[model samples]
Target chain A: MQDLLFYFFAVLTLIFGFLVVVNPFTRSPVTSAMFLVLSIISMSGLFVMLHAFFLAAIQILVYSGAVIVLFLFVIMLMDLKEEARSTFQGIRLTFSLLLAGLFATVLIGVVLTSGLGAEPVVLTLEGSTAVLGERLFNAYIIPFEILSVLLLVGMVGVVLLSKKNLN
Target chain B: MVGLEHYLVVSILLFSIGALGVMLRRNLLVIYMGLEMMLNAANLALVAFSRFNDNINGQILVFFIITVAAAEVAVGLALIVALYRRRRTTDVRELTDLKL
Candidate 1:
């Protein structure tokens, strides 16, 4: 059952991701942005399948919800002139695809040759939100606070950079 | 249950898509989207490892990564907007003022 959902969501994610890359053809940033949001949300579904519910929520909330909205807003604000199309020629693109295939083959080889391997030490982590929260507030507190600081810095930097252009 | 290889293969494919987008696409915004794709591929790998290893720490790190990714998108899009305002184009080849 869960495996079915995983494959379903994974295919959905791959489809939307492909659309996002191709949607630039319409010369519409808004459309591409929307496809990107769908792709992220589908990826979040993959996270949920992995039993990382909190991470899934954060993925959708942060990436699909907040960040993509910001991207759409910027795209709407700008006077995009049907940005120059992708530059890679057919030969180069074919080579890239071939290289990507080669890399995948090598990765599969490594994974297969590494043997089935010992069983992973599966900790008792399910339904343990309390433990997750406690650790977040305790051991991971510094990095957590640093992220907020980083957001602040990013916001201030944006304002300053935009202001420089105006004056 | 889905095995770890399934997750690993999906992530590798997604990461390659991002890399190809970066290498082949000429638009800055599209390239930024590609970067997001790469980050997401990494996030998938992290959560998959967390699941297979049965540890919450990996998921916790994913939370931090999401935070950083949000900030990165904000900053990157803002810069793209600024660049658009100044140059009127998002073409990578043309935005070479500081390329030296």
Candidate 2:
């Protein structure tokens, strides 16, 4: 059952991710952003399969919900001129794809040799939001507070950057 | 019997595609989307490792990563928008004003 779910989402994620990257036609950022929503949702599903239920929820709520909406909002705000409507051609295309292929081959080789994933360590990690909350409020409290501040700074920076004719 | 290797393989494939986008595509927004994809690939690997190790720390790190990623997207999109407004183009190839 778990394997079935994993393969389903893994394939879905890769397809959507490919669509997001180099879909042949309509290289519109908006289209890619929409596909990205699907990809993120699939990744979130994978997280659920991992039994990190809270993280999965956060992934969907934060990534697919907030981040993708932000991406769409920006795509709409900018006057996108159907940017890069054509596919890559000639040497650059082959070169980039070759590089990507080389990278994948190397990475896969490393993973095959590492054997880190072969045997999963048996340990108890309760997949409960309550436990996560307790840790967030206790041991990881400082970093969590710091992240809030970072978000505040980001908000301020975005407002300042996007403002027109700021005196 | 899907294991950590499966997740890592998926992640590396996603990462490579993202790198291709960043390298081949001229449009800055597409490149930014690729960047997001790469970040997501990393996040997936982190979650998988956490799961395999049966540790909560990896998931905890993922939470922080999400928060930081949100901030990054907010600021990054703002910068992209501002750049487009100034130059009337999102093509990085043409935004070479700082060429030396």
Candidate 3:
């Protein structure tokens, strides 16, 4: 049962992720963004399968909920027209696809030959929310604080950049 | 039985797809989305390793990564919007002010 779920989510993640990148049926960025949301949701399902339940919830809450919504808002705000179908052509398209395929083949080959044994470790500690919260506030506290500061800077930078007339 | 290798393979494929999107697409927004996908791919790998290793640090790192990604998207989208206001196009090929 678990194996079947894993395969289902993995395939869905790959399919939707591919559509997010290259949907032959639609040239609209909105369509891509929606597909990305589907991809992210399926990925979170993988997270759940891994027993990182907290991360799975956070993935849905932050990624599919907040991040993709932001993407849609920007897409709508720009009112972008459908991209030209001829944008990708000739040598550039071939080169990029070739490069990406080469990258995948090399990485997968390395992974297969690395000889890492596949014995699933009995998880002594599940990534429950309470434990994650404790770790976040305890051992990882400094990085946690730094992340907040980084977010503050990002928010201020975004506001300044988006202003109508920045001198 | 899905093992560590299976998860890693999925991660590799997703990362490659993201890279393909980044290199092949013209729209800056789409490219940005591709970048997000790449980051998520890394996150997926980290989570898998964390699980198989019986470590919590990986999940903690993923939490930080998620926060950083949110910040990145906010700032990145704002920059794209500002650029569109001035340049009126999101196509990457045309925004070549730095081309010498």
Q: Pick the candidate with the highest DockQ.
A: 3
Provide per-model DockQ scores. 0.62, 0.77, 0.84
- Where in model 2 is the C-alpha error above 4 Å? A84-87
| Per-residue alpha-carbon lDDT of candidate 2 for residues A1-167, written as tens digits (9 for 90 to 100) | 88999999999999999888777657778888888899999988888888889988998999999998998888788777765444477898899999999999999999989987666567467656997898899999999999888999999999999998656
lDDT tens per residue, model 1, B1-100: 5678788878887887777777666778878887898889988988887777777788888788888888788778878888888788888888777876
Flag regions of model 3 displaced more than 4 Å: none
Backbone clash pairs for candidate 2 read none
Task: Provide the overall lDDT of each model, using Cα atoms, as 2-decimal numbers.
Answer: 0.78, 0.87, 0.93
Q: Which tens-of-lDDT digit does each residue in A1-167 have in candidate 3? A: 99999999999999999998998889999989999999999999999999999999999999999999999999999878788898788998999999999999999999889865445566665889998999999998999999999999999999999999999
Q: Go through the candidates in order and give the C-alpha RMSD of each one to the true structure.
A: 2.4, 1.5, 1.0
Weakest ten-residue segment in model 1 chain A by summed lDDT:
A115-124
Give the winner by TM-score. 3
Model 2 agreement with the true structure over B1-100: per-residue lDDT tens digits: 6778888999999899889889888878889889999998998899888878878888889889998998999999899888877788888889888999
TM-score of chain A of 3: 0.95
Tens-digit lDDT string for candidate 1 (A22-87)? 664585667777888888988988987777777777778788889888887887787677754554
